[model samples]
Target chain A: MSAQTLYDKLWASHVVREEADGTCLLYIDRHLVHEVTSPQAFEGLKLANRPLWRKDSVVSTADHNTPTDHWDQGIQDPISRLQVETLDANIAEFGARAYFPFKDPGQGIVHVMGPEQGATLPGMTVVCGDSHTSTHGAFGALAHGIGTSEVEHVMATQCLVAKKSKNMRVAVTGKLGDGVTAKDVALAVIGVIGTAGGTGYAIEFAGEAIAGLSVEGRMTLCNMAIEAGARSGLVAVDDKTIAYVQDRPLSPKGEAWDKAVAYWRTLVSDEGAHFDHEVVLDGAAIVPQLTWGTSPEMVVGIDGKVPDPAKEADPVKRAGMLRALEYMGLTAGTPMQEIGVDVVFIGSCTNSRIEDLREAAAVARGRKKAATVKRVLVVPGSGLVKRQAEAEGLDKVFTEAGFEWREPGCSMCLAMNADRLASGERCASTSNRNFEGRQGQGGRTHLVSPAMAAAAAVTGRFADVRTLA
Target chain B: MKAFTTLDALVCPLDRANVDTDAIIPKQFLKSIKRSGFGPNLFDEWRYLDHGEPGMDNAARPQNPDFVLNFPRYRGAEILLARENFGCGSSREHAPWALDDYGFRAVIAPSFADIFFSNSYKNGLLPIVLPAEVVDRLFAECEAKEGYRLTVDLPAQQVVTPDGTAFGFEITEHRKRCLLGGLDEIGLTLLHAADIRAFEEKRRADQPWLFA
Candidate 1:
């Protein structure tokens, strides 16, 4: 019905065949599983008395359930432990490679680890059990989250019943300011586009600012692309992307390297390629932003006031905003900067990369932790990042500034481990999602950039770090 | 698995709207790619909480006698009466598996979460959406009575009740065929084996340098 927008071309090329029922059976190039969703799939296989179809195609990691504090024990929480252990057994049984127990260099959030290890190559279709799996699209891949049933389906048969999605290219130009991080840019785009604007489409993130971001930051931006209801998000691989992958363990060497780069260079949208929809945002126009409501879309710049639900164009949205405000203990006209936070979390697949840490450390220098702030934790995304940062004294800087330099793990992203906001407490975070009770029951979350998070740790409120710097 | 359809008898309790998938299987249970374990954790908070069954408390306790699935009235329910926008979060296949594993054949709601709605048909879990008033009527009628039964015919796109009442359901023509034909991932692939083999062979020859 439309000219190929990279998505159609990819889908049409990858379609192994069409089922008699008219559903097309597409082959999956990669299947990444995490501790949270792999247990059931492995158990299902056991129940069916079958082994993994292609054990090598499957990749497993223990992130959601493992704790940064303990390496000897798998996880402290029973629920987290159960899921992680389930994944471990499943992978062991099927002979799939798994990164587990601790956030060693090989283990981190599935999306982060995949790219860092060069497993997320260009032109591949990646699906994981986590919604943020869209993060892989930063490498020019078609990636999205799949369900447990779909996971089992892929395991039993490396195929998926996929519907063709429309292509959308969102462009944001200009240079980002001193303090605004990739998270802010992403939040601003979603805020303007609304949460469901990209529904039924795969987003291609292009333009100068997007192209300027480091590979990890690009991944962080694409990670939340699904938040806007897009199938996935991508940037055409460039020098930055190629440089990031050159030294990775799985990256090709010598002869293979030349071939890989040549193919990777071809992963861009051809000229005159049309997108179903488009949105353009000027990067320099945005300030540091955060979410004050339950959804990521109800975001306001740090200097702005909480939106009045009464002004919302839709009734359902209005009611939702009101509910979010009530839960967040805020009212209309409340300045977002004045909001005090009890804790500050600087981790998640979204912002735990080395660049994110360095950005926060730059703000944390010469700044002491707030006496009123209960906890300021900085968890690196992977052991490699942790080791690299520590070697560079980044960890020392964070710790000296009263931040807890925790081990590499998905700490404080969810209550999967020991790090979680106590009920009724408010936190400044770098992770995506601010849904009610998302962190913990009755806990409030304000999604911000890493610099803003560090600033929150210093000032105990959402402050504009650029001014402080 | 056998396929059958009817929707007239499907009924749920008081209107619980916007049933997101996080509340269905939850982000907590999504750590693995497996589907079976989620059945136990389906609505883990709701199923064990007082809100779900009216008299349950202390979800952490070993015994909660008043949970919804533990209730007598809703026992052996083939059709599920759900609130609006059920299954609204991440396109995980586990949501449908959890629902299907728990023995729900069809989920009737005013609206369905987009991803979950698509996944339901693939997993053989029929998701039916009717007008809010119509759904409310069915829920009320069932609550007023008991053992409400609704039947759905995928080919006909209709749901039939015990008293000969009939209601039409909507589905994409393609998905409707998928459900009726009882096709799954492997089944779909097998149906196109010849074409797939040819495509693979041709690609292998055309891109000989690319194969590993």
Candidate 2:
């Protein structure tokens, strides 16, 4: 056997058949579905008169369109209500291994809920209709997003038609600075490697800085892989990964657990493995990061200034920067810290776990949200995460500091629900994307870490968390 | 999925890089369960001056005059010419769905995001990747002249400009065949039911805990 990358090993083990053209029918171990992308897929299945190949292979929830603030009011928007109801009806007719419908104690963002429930495990292939399915790759799983057509294909047959992705290694060595977290590391990686740098490749985040992160932190890094144009990202399994998967409801018990652990231990890449592309970054040099522009790649350290398009040599890139500046209402050479924010959103699949909430709450413990800031929303990733935050008094800390402690849903992340930004309203968000009109039709979103979002909430500007006394 | 063989259509040059899916079709319109009807809302925010919602009368909305799609010269354009890393955001297939519904049979770009590239093929929207220099030339030609159209011959794997300059593009034979024949991927994969079952059985024995 030749030395192989972890991605190669995972790819080989899952291959059911390989066509002459190099397309492989890869087996999917778990499928996570949500409201937004699954409806059309379900409709496709029904139109084709196809039955779900293996119902037990699926776990579903309604997160993207569910209201975060007013569950008691019961989804005021009629269209949003119908979408959630459609998911419930589809799951009832199609069946699933597990389902956490809206208001279910276990319900949360699919990416956050899957790993927390142990449904996303090591050395298996996980997929979802949502792009952030890469978040599950933190467990050393081969996970990626599939379009609705592929989603229907997976439902009809428990296999995905896939081609092997090139292997890319992003090695971040040295120690991270104080107040710099996984979100910063993820943003820094994107800043260094343009969004298309990892296209057609699966990136493995390794080295000392990666090894030092908690599993939740690893997920945050992997969640942003799609933003960098890669469909999937991975971290090799270790003691931390095993501990994270240890005793969840879906995890193997007793003898099975020991066997699973042994298998997972071999999930790392073999020495002398060849990679198609490689990038290296120093963790110590990475500061708290924020996207001053619309694209994730358009990020800079909090201490940096908004980029001037005139300095950009490439006309296409310069035009893009100019458009972003106009849309974000930013000026060239303006210090990032001086930019004010109207809203602070500290939730998304990217950073809404208990660890993220704890980080944000630590920054908001005694401080008040700035009077200039209109609203500060702190949404937990899952109902379980919300309960855990409440248990630790994190919710109280946020509420006392003038933040709205909301329910577990995507909320303003995509703003499919009522929680959204008004036109021209600038927001400091912990969500994955800062694309134009992402939060709302004309909203301006600046991507940052949970702690960074909290810092922005307190000061009503892009404040450096490290400078917070 | 519609079979895409050849297209010689007017080009609508959207000279932008990293156009994300959120901008392609806003999240607000994603509430619809059906795939159709997304065309009217395609590039919703960029095309219209006001906010767009599902079921809104698109004809009544004031069109952004500066938007290239609204230009009278590019009216009924069926091909979109774009910059690098087109369709570079969330994995909402709605981007391609919207483009296809809006009468775009093909899109030519310097590069494309992996997921969007694959999704485009599944929806019968040919995403042609050309060299950056070639794409730049095409954008220049498209912008310099009105009613400029390109002929995309997928079977020949070439995109021909009106001036007889043809640029070849690369695509996997498997994807090309699927698109040419309008094949159903799931139906085709199900042809190997026995192989899938055997592999599953072996996987269950090798990693029993996964089943447990």
Candidate 3:
């Protein structure tokens, strides 16, 4: 009986070479790219006049800078248009396929579209130049973000040099209470561990709470794994994972499916797996979380109070609290429940899945958005998610509640697309990262779960959605 | 560019928490990638006013008295004082490029988001991590004196004031070696050139079918 943590097992099997200072070169199975970071690397390739090392193993997409509205073949923003066009030309020239333009059924946020379209599989290592590449860990793959140069390196050579990080397991037990979603679970883990707690670690999600989540929910949980400061977050593939990818367009078929399932089923860490460190949380105890400060770690349950600057006994932490208060126009000890929201956004790779939409729609079923709330945007993660939501009439529910059911893409996730918060508007967002001015200049963002976003939309303040039901 | 290193330089002007990449470089200016001209646009909105275009010497301007970075004491700065979640949002490496291009050698913060933090390190910029209490003291000291200079020694794992006040910080030895060597990922790759070439030859020999 082999007793090993998932991280140790994964790292040991994948180790190609060990470097000085304890870094190991691990092989990468898949490499994904996007418009924002690919230009330079392609330029590097062009400079070298080298054909890509392998085209089949690499994929590209245009998501970060693409708008979610009607696909304008001629986009208005020249920078965005050129980047997209340049990438298109490069991919065509390289014989690499790329998902481009509006609402590509294969086109959605790269992280979401990758797994939904079966581009991501379990027991594989995936890397994207974008940080949220950790999102694919839901399928039990060790996925992490890489630099643009590394992207080119991987394009030129499929293998990557990686340091073997410490393995940690975060076990969240107990069933989630009503109004809590996968976004809440991820936020709860991050709040307890703080952002950098997982530094130099690969965290595995396990225990009853994680096992209970569906595949889409699992994706949401793993999407912001980087938020916890882990190199990647992974969950062992299970029936739920297999079911999700089984019938997808690009998934392995017939005999290939059998081989994939056989391999995936073997990916689970053995029982009694030992981890270097362990953290535990009870899902039932978690409330709707909202980030009151700039960092994702500076979060408290919706029913909690803003931390007192003085209470942060360490001077550096206290200074951080004070500065956060200044940027947020919030005071220490202010009740999070009393905070009012100027805008409500319920999309992003974090919470743009169909399950997130269903949860928001369930909350907004018979309700009208509060009069004070100015904007409510519901951007789905992928065209598939959008199509499924429309089939279920979830879009109608959102529209009736005064929310705009937008097309698929990474809309307003980082304000890379046209979607953004006007300056000074405090927004309740279902996205990760509430850094000061993340949405726009001087714009404040309070990160929360989708239901909380819907609740904020209905009442125009950071109200507790758990209490609404 | 006389071998200017982030070590012994760079401190935050305002002790701010969550000084995002946008604050490092606002979104509107992410329109190009020439890599030669982002310095003028760094902190464009905060340092300039209605009448000021990007090219003017921002330090000479009346300056937005209300802007967090424009406090009187920390003018002509090299160091930045920041709090947790510094450099959150979009993975555009350009954010750090703008800061590095615009004369920022180092950022002293209690914490940083993972992507931005790693990006900063790779771009020949130093990101110093000090305890929250130590960071607060630096902020207060920078605030107290006009043009107070702070020095950071990467090899010593300490930050010092002009008056020789020293504070210890944390960094992994691997990162220290990388920064001290001025090695980017390319440099990392070049280190293993022999091993890579040998591996390529071996792989080709083992799988003759894979080659042209």
The DockQ of each candidate is 0.32, 0.85, 0.26
Best of the candidates, TM-score = 2
Deviating ranges (above 4 Å) for candidate 3:
A70-73, A331-338, A467-469, B1-14, B43-62, B66-90, B108-112, B128-184, B187-212
Q: What are the runs in model 1 whose C-alpha is more than 4 Å off?
A: A1-3, A19-22, A97-104, B1-4, B13-19, B27-86, B91-94, B97-105, B108-114, B129-153, B159-174, B181-184, B191-212
**Number of backbone collisions per candidate:** 27, 0, 10
Model 3 Cα lDDT, one tens digit per residue, A66-148: 77776755466777778778778878877553354444576778888788767787777788888788889898888988766
Winning model by lDDT = 2
lDDT of 1 by residue, B56-171 (tens): 24345343445556567876776788666566556667678778887778888877655677678767888888887778778777777877777677778877766767788777
Q: Candidate 2's residue-wise lDDT over A246-301, tens digit each? A: 99989889988998899999999999999999999999999999999999999999
**Residue pairs in candidate 2 whose N, alpha carbon or C atoms collide under 3 angstroms:** none
How does each model score on lDDT? 0.75, 0.93, 0.75
What would the DockQ be for model 2? 0.85
lDDT of 1 at B179: 66
Model 2 segments beyond 4 Å from truth? none
Give per-model CA RMSD.
4.2, 0.9, 4.1
**What would the per-residue lDDT of candidate 1 be over residues A335-360, giving only the tens digit for each residue?**
88888999999999899988999999
